[model samples]
Target: MTLSRRPAHRDVPETAPVAGPIRVDPRTKNLTKRLTAGDIAVINHEDLDQVSAQALVACRPSAVVNAAASISGAYPNLGPQILLEAGIPLLDRAGEALMTQVTEGVDGSVVGNEVVVDGVVLAEGTRLDMPTVLEAMEAARGNVSQQISSFARNTMEYVKNEQDLLLDGIDLPELRTPMEGRYALVVVRGYHYKEDLQTLRPFIREAKPVLIGVDGGADALVELGYRPDLIVGDMDSVSDATLVSGAEVVVHAYRDGRAPGLDRVESLGVEDPIVLAATGTSEDVAMLLADGLGCELIVAVGTHATLIEFLDKGRQGMASTFLTRLRVGGKLVDAKGVSLLYRSRISGAALVWLLIAGLLAVVAALAATPGGRTLYQVLAVRWDDFWAFVGGIFG
Candidate 1:
């Protein structure tokens, strides 16, 4: 009954699928006791996006608690979860302090089968009641305010000297602002964004925000039925259609003005339009573009702002993201958790079918052997007829 298992380790160089920002949970006990505000708590994995990371990092907890399972337990997540690489200590066991906070938050936030944000329970189990949910959301907003506030303040100060490293050899594209009072959705490559776009479609359809995709995110947006307004990045992971979607194209380049992406876009017949030469990651570029264009709100998708996520992308530090946050401070909104907001369950019928298929296979295999030879012979009076039936199925 045991299924064949693949070895946990493989020698071959396999192409791993790109996933969204790594999510890690804090596992330290007595968080209130062990951690202080402005402590620089590098969360192991919170499934947070760039803005959230910035907000959390801004809190500046006393020390980072890398509760991310990978660093703590080698449990795989989307990317290498952040805390360990951020010069933060990795906590293996969920200590009393951390769990106490999570429990208190959950209890104080919930009533009966419902989760209460403020005094209202948003949902009972899986069904959402928006009124209650909204109340909870409002309450939850300020729960992490101190952290976010500190992160913003600290990052702004930290990046002042590192601006050149962030802006090094990068191009700043000339952005054309066609609409006012509109928001911009900046897409970056990250976890389940493609699948989550199904849920995001309604938001896009309703908000009608200007869509901007960075590199592979350009293709991701297209896959999710969104025609990007402006595709920005090095053109490394985008498609030709995304580049030529008639939206303003901005190529993020090094400070040297020598963009590797420029040549590819040109070869694709995309003429010289606009390219922003900067020294940061494309997500950073996208945020700056949104800011420069005066977008009222910038909702980010799959963007990485954590030191771990930046490091996992092979960058040594988070200097660029740190600076970008200061530039787009209040207007930024991270849509990273939009994916984990829903719960899906297997249907009863599906379970029934699975059980039936498994039983049928076992019965067939058993009947084929000496275990049920007499029964098999009794069922197979005519071998030719059985063979014909099998052949007919193939036909």
Candidate 2:
């Protein structure tokens, strides 16, 4: 059965909810890839961020049944709002039993705020509408100052733990690709990444920057027809195909040198993949790696740079990112900002069409005025005479 597009916020009245097949996954990212239109997405994601929410919205799911709290009121997360704005019915905090009771691919119905299967209520939760979401966002915003204070404290504590990142570009793992004095492109799968990459296409073509992908960002780069020169992350989100795709893999380990993701890399038959134990996010590690290798410029795509963006990722601290950016200094450029600043040149066909339009305008003006017509006739005769002389000489 086909489902009609959900009406806008104003149009949607108080009524029974739409029904569809249920697709369940704890991870929002994994669920996004498998979700189809008219399906109900059952996810266990807590405090859903805007990026994941946007991904879920792209799938056009009829409804979302979250096993965990969609918004824990941590810091005004944007995911729930995005989903509600897109007119997707969200039943937040549906409980773990819903995941167990609601079988995948089964005909599930969202009647009001409850998940019903085979005439039985499997789970019931609060239906997140616009007003509720907005109110929550306002409350979350009020708590932001507290979160910021906490974040600052965490950053200071982290500085004490990881001062090496600032003092000396901490020890980096040896890699096959050389990065010294070269341009580097580090991609993280966050915040309008697809659009940013689309805008950076010309830059990518011109500079051919050393492509570095953090975990699933490698898959994103591969999807965009660019092979990653280095893949650095915990290896949880990236696929096996990407691991074997010839990118030099770097497993981001804990400060104590525990490389959990290295086992996955080894299982994939990647030869001599390096492990860099660090006290920061993988994206931070990737930047430090490039900077340590003396990269002249570093372009960051989809990497979180803003305070809210960092908070959206559920980060209580930005110490490593703070230090990494300071160390890289002038070399680091955010792709979103770069895309906004970079103007694309007009295409050849577009320029040709513009020239043709200008000529037509000139011809019309010549036809409109007697003096212009006389001048045009004189120019036509002179142009023909000049071409005739050239033709005679050439022929």
Candidate 3:
């Protein structure tokens, strides 16, 4: 054995970087399900909406690195601004390489404007500070007209083919939950859904509408200490715990008989789930189900009601939503953004007037009774004494 082998060099152990673990997800909503505090969120989202932004803020991530543009100059997307406002560092336009290369649970650090993974610089991006987000928003605002035109054209095109399906109504399976002639509260995890749900606390207490959760809305209901009576959606965002919480499940599938969520429902041990193969968004399906099932009134929360909100979602499927609203018609009352508008059904002034009217009525009734004159003298004497006592203290 001739030559002596050289001693092998000892490899130094890599030190752990002072940063949070990175969680990579193309779908922000899905990532949020597992995201925890002080984690780094790497999302592949373009034109991030307000709802998504709020969800991220709730998780309180250390930083956010986006493979795609968070704003994208696509109609003043609010997500980037929200993240910045929440003090979460946002690195935008880091490209696809970062997403493909960085595995979940890797240590991620933000030094200046670069995203370093395990001490290696994975990507560099524009740090979205408040000013940057505002400027981007302003530019995005200018493109609103173009976006609107595109939305309209897309809606018209889709309606030509999907109109029949929407009008025909869903052939819903018989469910244990009753809906005829009762108010239905259909929730979607859309814009400010939590706030809207909280504002409707009194109404929910009084009406006791059938709690219908669309996808993640099921989780939303559970968060607010209410169990959904019916869970409807593609089953992507709905949690397993909520699925098995004794609520009737309605699996929303594609109109062409392709039901991806069905497999998930079955896998979760949810038996007897009604598979409704219908078109449009899950929220639309929920509303249509309520309307078709003879729900007297359907109150929608966290749905795309405003024009700006519709555009913000940046989905072509909004055409279905537009038609679904028309289909639901007068019975549909959108409670999205309701927290901004609703302070009280009865105003303070009105309540004061009502109190005065009642007091006057009571006084008049009491004065008209027998022994009323004697009682009135006694009250007048007491009232004078009370005022005299008060005056004595001051004077």
Candidate ranking (lDDT, best to worst) = 2, 3, 1
Task: Specify the highest-lDDT model's number.
Answer: 2
Q: Which residues of candidate 3, in runs, are more than 4 Å off?
A: 1-18, 336-395
Worst 10 residues of 2 by lDDT: 1-10
Q: Give all candidate RMSDs, comma-separated.
A: 21.3, 8.9, 7.5
Q: State the TM-score for model 1.
A: 0.46
> What lDDT does each candidate get?
0.54, 0.84, 0.84
lDDT for each residue of candidate 2 in 1-395, tens digit (9 for 90 to 100): 11122322333338557888999988888888789999999999888998999999999999998988988887888899899889898988888766666688999777776677776767767888889888888888888898888878887887787787788876877789999889999988888887788898878888888999998888888988888999999998888988999999999999899999998899889988988888788988999899998899899988887878988765443667877788887899989766766656679999999999999998898799999989989999999999999999999
Report lDDT (Cα) of residue 343, candidate 3. Answer: 44
For model 2, how many clashes? 0
| Predicted candidate 3 versus true structure: per-residue lDDT over 104-159, tens digit per residue | 99776766556775456677677777887898899888998898888889888877
* Candidate 1 lDDT by residue in tens digits, 1-395: 11111222223223221111122244222232233343423243433233233333334342333332222211112222233234322222222233223222222221222222334322222222334334443554454444445555655665675566444423344556453578888887654455556666756776788898887778778776668788888776676777876667788778778888888887777755576776567888788777766689888887665533553333222556766776687888767553344334569999999999999998988878895878777678778689999999999
Give me the runs in candidate 1 sitting further than 4 Å from their true place: 1-173, 176-179, 305-310, 314-317, 336-395
